[model samples]
Target: MARIKPQALLQQSKKKKGPTRISVTTIILCNLVVVLIVFFLFSTYRHWSQRSRFQTDNQFSASEDGNAFMDAKKADVPGYAVLNTSKGFVTVELFKESSPEVVDEFIDLCQKGHFKGVLFNRVIKHYVIQAGTAQGLGATEDWTLRGKHYNQLDMSLNLKHEAFMLGTSKGKRNDKGFELFITTAPIPNLNEQLIVFGQVVKGEEVVQEIEEVDTDENYRPKSSIGIINVSLRQKI
Candidate 1:
């Protein structure tokens, strides 16, 4: 039998040792990548959970139905509008400073009884109750106002959709529109979508009642809920 030389033994050892180092490094890198992936997943889940919690807490607070009255808050409110509906009265404090033209147009419409027979056609649970459109909830109306651009109507007001806030947005044409919506909860999702021209300074409970009313699958009230009329109060 031939005896193996020392150099050959050393070369064989080198091959085995070289592969071991490479394998060890690859395993370490793979494990590190897995750790990073898990950490990222955990962080994303935590962020989502926190946001959901915040949304729930804020919604609860907004729905508490706190003191609803035309008090000091309405002192410098510029104006107010009382909407007489089938359910009850909903008084809104107009945001004339932020949205002048839209506010004025709304006031004009209210005083002229434009919404006299319009129904509260749409009501989304925990969302908004929409009205003020001549063609009911779906069809687009040709309500021409002073300004044609969206900014003049305060469509860029970017007001957070809080409970009782009255807002309007365009239909398919996509500009400052006449259809108005009364929100029943704080909706952050609608932040930059609609123009909030006023907020309910009074009759919050009335809004709650309207929102709690039964509706069809299409969110239309099972029972007729019409806007008897809207009265504008320049001095709140």
Candidate 2:
């Protein structure tokens, strides 16, 4: 056998070094790839986390407002009434001092859940709904028995039924509880007759929709505008 030369051994050593250099380069590239993947995953997770936090904050704000309104009602302080109707929610600030009798009657009825499922009987388009008539042609007929006592109250207080009047009167001297009406047009005839107590603060579109409903021969709504619930809310 021929003996190997020193230069030939050196050449073999150079060939082995080539593969070792390639292996080291491959290891470095793999480490760089792993670092990039980790960075991308971390960035995506952070984005998702921030978005979730934002949604949670918005929901919390809405819930807080609702809770505050409920708290105000429980206190019996001068608060607004939130009327949930089929069309939309309407908010009206009750004038307790200006119309004490009417406000007291409305609060009492609300506490007893009398206005629930009631209907907006008479709706004149662009005018108002002449409700609390106990016509028995609309949604609920629970309050129909109270029709006789609708206008049975005395008129010595000089309560006038103007625009947005929350009075219970048949014509002029019959102001009592369990009756309310909102006006769109100028009805000066009710200036010194009905008791103006509250004005609508929200959901005027719901009022507009009520006014646009089909009416009967007596100008009453063909179908009743149902009052889902009437709860007191605080003005925030």
Against the true structure, what is each candidate's TM-score? 0.53, 0.52
User: Candidate 1: lDDT of 202?
Assistant: 89
Model 2 Cα lDDT, one tens digit per residue, 49-124: 9999999999999999999998776566556888888888888888876776667767777878887887777665
TM-score between candidate 1 and the true structure: 0.53
- Candidate 1 lDDT over 1-236, as tens digits, reads 99999999999988774433457889999999999999999999999999999999888776653423434444434488888988888888889879877787776666566788788777665567888543423432211111122113343345455567888864442122367788776665555557778889889998888878787655668998878888877565
Error of 2 at 195 (Å): 1.0
As for model 2, its CA RMSD to the true structure in angstroms is 17.1
Candidate 1 accuracy as lDDT: 0.70
lDDT leader? 1
